[model samples]
Target: MATTPAGRHIRNPQGTGGRLRADILAAAGRILESTGSDDAVTLRAIAREAGITAPAIYAHFADRDAIRRTVIEQTFTQLATVLTTAADTEHEPVARLHVVCHAYLDFAARRPHHYRLLFERHRAARGADAGPAAPDVGSIVGADAFGVLLQAADSCIRSGASTAVDPVASATRVWVGLHGQATLQASLPWFPWPPADRLATDVVRRMADLR
Candidate 1:
């Protein structure tokens, strides 16, 4: 729709085409978030949203999966960043974990489709990454978030936080608990839960209460 606006796509990243690529990727991200990395993320759709055409998407992405992968990868990294920052804020072992729970839920509620496209919707369901989703090459938040949970559980172990004392299991349970609340909120919004953030905070509190 908008004219190439002078040297648009032809310009390299930072050299000339800065605006075009940015616009395409952002549109792709929104499409992924809103549409669950479905068929709509096609070059044509992205281009259409960008007021361009299929050729424009090709210029930006290798193929549909590449774009989907990029969007998914970036989304997880962002989710991890939110959790890590929350974990960093508090001093108490339990409270630190609670911060992570709230942060994670906050991210989900605020970006429900992005959250769903990332974790809740199975890749098979969407027909993306057919074999399985690729593992993170060099993770940003997912691995870091797990590390924080492990560290907290380790503290729980050292401080006699619970009788059921397997650090990995404990950490996993916490993950499951928090994710359970989030998943319910995401997948079945009609089932009646508190606000997403509240449900998540409650789960986190309950997890820390383990004895």
Candidate 2:
């Protein structure tokens, strides 16, 4: 066992390589959460947080971009699971849609740093040079999360609970509103805002055209 620069004892223990990978990712996540900036998630910082040498990180991740991508993927997975569970709690189409909206808001509120990484920072990273063909947030987060939101919106339309003609368009509108709301709430927590549940419900109803 060797002591890392952070004065923490570290041990690879031969077959724990998989575990080390997970630890590296976890440490990176903590750094992102604390700093809320990708620029702060340097290899040295992650290694220090993980109690491992910077070279060891190279064994698991090719570079900082790989680590960041993995972290974003994990965050999206968590959000999708939460939204799916929230939607399952209510059987009615309209109610399920509202619940999913609340879950989305809850995720943003609970993990502001992760939310920033996923949306704000991600957009900045994609850059204007990425061109029109670059993948957007929905694609980047993948089908799991965005699919849940779209499915919920489609459910409302299929059940006649929503007056929207195009589920895709309606879902896009709902996503836009939810993102805006979450961003505003996180940036202006001191502002006088409506209750979270009430605000989320209103956004869903209006955006999804839910009856």
Name the top lDDT candidate: 2
Candidate 1 off by > 4 Å: 1-19, 33-37, 120-141, 192-202, 205-209
User: For residues 1-211, what per-residue lDDT tens digits would candidate 2 score against the true structure?
Assistant: 3457997767656446888899889888988888878789999998888777889888888888888878887888899999999989998888888888889988998999988888655643444466655455455544588888888898999999999988779988999999999999888989999997888888888999987
Measured against the true structure, the TM-scores of the candidates, in listed sequence, are 0.72, 0.87
Deviation in Å, model 1, residue 209 alpha carbon = 6.3
In model 2, where do residues sit more than 4 Å from their true spots?
A: 1-10, 121-131, 134-139
lDDT of 2: 0.83
Candidate 1, residues 104-174, lDDT tens digits: the string is 77787788777766654335333543445445422322555667776776676667655546776777777
Q: What is the lDDT for 78 in model 2?
A: 94
User: What TM value does model 1 have?
Assistant: 0.72
